[model samples]
Target: MKVLPIFLLLFYMALDGLHAKELPSNGNDEVIFPITELQIYADERGFVNFSDVLNGEVEFVISEDFQPKDYSVDSYYWIRFPLHLNNIESKQWLIEFYDQTIDVIEAYIPTLDGSYKKITMGDHYPFYQKSFDHKNFEIQIDPKLHGEIVYYFRVKSHTYADIRIAVRSINRFIEYSLFEYFLYGLFYGMIFIIILYNLLMFIAIREVKYLYYTFYIFSVGLYATCVDGIAYQYLWPNSPQWNQIAHGVFLFSLIFWAMVFGHRFLNVKNSAPRLHKAIWAVIFARVLLFIYAIVFDNSLFEYRNIEILPLSLIFYTGVYVLVRGYRPARFFVMAYGLLFLGFLIKALLNISVIPFSIVSYYSLHICFLMEMLFLSYALSDRVRILKSNRDRAMQRIILQHKENVKLKDKVNRELERLVDKRTTEIQEKNIMLEEANQKLNQQTAEISKINSILDLDNWKLKNNIKEILQDRLINKNLTLEEFNKIFPDEVSCFRFLDRLKWENGYSCSKCANTKYNDGQQKYSRRCTRCGYDESVTSNTVFHKIKFPIEKAFYILYLTNNRQNKYTLDELSEMLSLRRNTVWNFKKKIEQAFSDKEDSHLIITDLFSYHINKKVS
Candidate 1:
């Protein structure tokens, strides 16, 4: 696909050459001159007609009437020759002239005789003369010369041989010119695209290499254009002053781009830092040469020659890289090789050491075109390689991400299991705590019931004591000791008196004394010697007692043991006492206990009977 265009271009070059020719028009008459030999004759009279050259060294005579004119003067003369023929024929030929003084001059074959009949020279007429013999011809010269003149003429054979050669030459020139123009357009277009594309790449990637490559490509393109002569022909034809400078600039840029593009393309540092530095040194030398050219335009030729040395170095470096298996270096070597060969050929041809022709002019451009195509392909290959690697890397990244997700899921599952186990353990502990709380609540309820029973027993025991004290009148002279012996297994007699005293100590029952008897014996025979037959129990709890002390103590013991008021009532029934009497006894004892509670002193004295009994 790529080679097709090159083939077509070559085909056009060939065809253009084959078909090219210069045709004669109606106003131009072709001339043909025939001569056996050219000879020079001289005579004493200076009148010479030395037309025959085979007569042997004839010192031909010259007419004294002729005056020699200096043909060295800058002037022009119109000359014509007639061809006598039987039938009208058009002839085309190229006239060749050799002269050391051929200045700006124009010549054309005249198609008509007497075309300028009125035009005269100094003494003769300017007109073509017809020949007497039909096969013979006459040559006419206008503005006749007065001195010796030398001129040789021949007709460029328009025959097949000559035509073929001329057509080939002319066509080759045109084809080359057109091809060069095309190459200029192509390379310039490529340079523009490269610059724009790489500039955008630099912006997008922010890679310094892209910027360097952009500058390098631009420089290379400019240098290539200039070296190819396309810059002169198309870009700056009228600017002759820039010609030398353009050459220097082209060489400088070529070396610069060579170094930069090579360094970037080959990964110079990793591949060959020493070679890279050498290449840069060569480039720097080329830069110096360029500067010298700028500073001394007159010595431009010398500086240009100096530049070629660095260019040679660069070429060798490229060759080394390419041989070392640098992939891009292959293209670089190929392109630079073609360019260098083209330049060498052009230089040889331009110096006239070789004939300058169309093939020579365009061969360089074709090579350049080939170079550009190869370089572009190389760059495209680089892009493809980069894209492929990127895709692979992206795939790897995606796979890694998927693996990471799987690992994360496994971790989450493990964490969830741990959380569930912890929750279950906490729930079990809460249940155990609830059971323990329920047991504690039952224990608390039983303790409350036991306390209530103990309270009831205490109340019954206090009531029994009150009943025994209330029977004082009926049980006169009944000593507490005797009372205790009657209820032997019950409260002691001293305890009964202590209970009665606690109830009636503040109120004298016989005397109705409200003052407490602090010194009175608990079982005194008479209340403070009253001697009125009043017993210590007179007007006290014992005065009103109906139940026997022994039975009452038994009931108290039973009630205190059972700790139930109902048990006390049953016992009373067994003793054959009225329920009302037992009940009244219970009420009076409770009341007496209540009164004792109010009258008892919370004494701090250690010798108090209350304090001593509490300790016992």
Candidate 2:
């Protein structure tokens, strides 16, 4: 059995060697083959068959007699070759040939008409110059290959030669096409997610920072896709107009985002003035470049070159600010650094210093993604810092509130002390006022008692004078002098009585009635009120009392002014009577005056007058 396998292997090697050296021939500027019929068969018996000439027939025909007689051998050779295989594990095959005399031989494969390959031939005897055209080829079997498989072969006029070529070009095209599609889908998907995420952030934060970041991410995505040729080849194949415009759009967007993001990230206003000025200059340059691109389309390349200058300027400025401990500057430096590296790599590739391949094409986009991730972290850090600042402000407010509360408490206590002091002072003043009022009331009562006593004494004296006048009137012949002598203790009383008798009514005693009153001799009443009366004694003690009538009328006044024992002795001398008789008359008059003072009528009238005066 082993010998059988060895003999089969040797036979296979010899057949392969023979096939390797076989070459098709052309006659009369045309090529022909000895075997014309070809067929392929396969069955379930694990066997495959290729029959080029059925029934061992070598019957083939070539009609080359119609060729022009002047045609050269190089001009007329034409051939068709068909290849088929069964039970073939390889998707590609090789054909070989050799030629001895011809310095150059051309072979053509019709199945792969649009394809070209070079073949070399080796020297062999009989000057066996071989040429391959359509006539010498035949299909023996159709080989089964997966995925866009086709069969084609080349022939050469050589004794031995080797052909090495791929027979499945269709599969490679399909694989590359799918791979590029996948990359495009993946890139766009990431861009979509970035847009959605940034949109959400903008809504939640209501911050222009988020808006700038969104545009930055969109510009980055466009730049990456354009650099990769994905946008031109797959996304918009027929829109060359869009492709040309995309370049300027991408550049403009990039610069705009850089300017906006730089301002937000660096807090340019708070930075050093020179640094801030430099940043503004970069922004101005970007604007000039954008405007230049719009006004002059041919300046787009110049704009792109100018953009790099500003980018570098912004990047270094941001680095400076960041190193100076500007909080936002740190994020800007990191993000711009990533973008700058990406752009640097892409620029180098575009200038052809670097090979155009997958790694070079995707390097910039990957860097951009890294930049975005870093920026997100920076934004999160900024949010944390803002929150911390807000919390500190709130704490300050709370502290201020606490201080206000303490101040209010102190003020309230002070006000309460003032109120208490004021209340105590008012209470003390009220007590003092009450004591003063009590003293005033007691003084007023004592004054009222003294006035009542004086009024009662006055009334009693008046009544006593009136009683003496009535006694004299009853004794019609009694002269004023006699009456005064009898009642010397009441001399004023006697004078007042004489005046009452002379006058119809009481009159002034100091100025006596004169003129007609003195001339009247009739015994009619005569005074200021009436004419003078002859019965009225002008020099009698009654008319000429030592004291005034008002003072002398009161008994207490007489007693208080006169000497002791004068009531009776003085009255007897003035009246011309005995001392005992004068004494008895004086005593009786004093008793009547004292008795009248104690009467209820006098006391009641004095009290009533005092009460009426108080009411009025």
Candidate 3:
């Protein structure tokens, strides 16, 4: 029975050795397992264990594709490669995985004791727990392999991971990593310098376009680091899960700021108006996509090719504006053009359309560098063109000033010549005017005596007419037109009240102060001692009347006149006031007269002067 088990083991080893490749002896030797050399199997149920794989229960299929891939995120991919490692005596060897973004990796190596040893490593764990302090996944093979052995690596990720395993001697791995990090330094250094320069430009120029460009390039750098695992190793060494989502975060920022910067720099709102509205729509859509990726499904972040849409739109906007005769858009077009090509090459690589290489892998970084330089040049070129236009305008103004100065000099000379001729003509006219002036002076003395006599007669005539008009205001038979002749408006009525109420002297209504300054009103007085203001109508029967002062003055004049025969309706029609308004005012005046204690004095005249004796 033991012989039967040894015979079965030998038979299985013979079958596996047929597919095994020889492990190199030199530590400098490097080898890559292509799709033809490796066998792939997906654990769709994720329940297949190492015992099933070792017992030859699971079937593995060889892929004809250029690179092996974990196509579905819902399953685990088990990749097995048979290697003749019986000759690993000369130097050390390690398995290196190129894709650092894989969430989990389990390497199962066959031991000389005829059992499989398992090792688990991935970005899901902290960086401090990593076997090798490097960006890529590396597993060191022990020198205990007896004969041909099959190595199995179970790859699982939330996103599609490119499965490329390179078997390198320690010497080659060291050389390759040093050169890669060196190139990364140069790449990031240039980006840093460009970002710093653009940031300074934004600060100095105070333009929003420069600010947007600065943030766009910064996002590019951060995303590149996240893609290659440099950020996991150095940025957040403790948090490996962040390595998964950093790319999506930075890429969202990258395209977002790029669209914004392009909009302003291209002057797209004015240049391509219809397309201008479309850019914002695309931005809105991109934002919605990013939100969905974060909140619901982070796997959507792996759809990096979606960025091509916005970048293409930006490129088209640059072209459209440039074709419309916008000269500053030249560098802008070149910048986005290279960027679009980089994304194109990357998208092609994702599908195995382009061969994977160091140059091909970092193509986006190179294009980002080129695009950064061109965009800075674009901003500077715009400023240069604007300065040229301003300089030309200044030159035109200077030339116009010179022309105006010559025209003004010519006008001054013509005016001087005209003035000389006019001066001589006026001198001759002065002599004739002086001789005529003597005769006019004698005639003026005779006219002056007659003018003085006429002015004195005119002054007396105006006074006699004014006295008669004022005197007729006391007549009861006067009509509305006749009453207006003495008090035509509120000003005339207030003036009469001012003169009649303060006929003897001025007095404050509240404090009865004899001294006062000018009040706020025209015919009102303010007391100097108590500061009380006595208006022209304050103490009179006309105070606070609802109708106009002249109308109230007319009503009072008619009421005081004993001969007045006009009824309330007739007075209302003549004064154009309501009957009740006219009647109410008449009663108010009568009440003032009835309130006076002096029965001997005329009612209207005595009532006004009763309290303060102001109208006496």
Best by TM-score: 3
**Candidate 1, residues 99-140: lDDT per residue as tens digits?**
101212222222222112221111011112221111111223
Evaluated with lDDT, which candidate comes out highest? 3
Error of 1 at 222 (Å): 4.7
The local distance difference test score of each candidate is 0.48, 0.50, 0.81
Q: Which segments of model 1 are wrong by more than 4 Å?
A: 1-238, 300-330, 340-361, 418-616
Clashes per candidate, residues 3 or more apart or on different chains: 23, 20, 0
Error of 1 at 120 (Å): 29
Q: Please give the distance, in angstroms, between residue 553's alpha carbon in candidate 2 and its true position after superposition.
A: 89
Residue 482, candidate 2: Cα error in Å is: 94
Q: How many backbone clashes does candidate 1 have?
A: 23
Off by over 4 Å in 3: 1-12, 24-28, 66-70, 86-89, 143-147, 351-359, 418-616
Candidate 1 at 577: error in angstroms? 99
Candidate with the larger TM-score of 1 and 3? 3
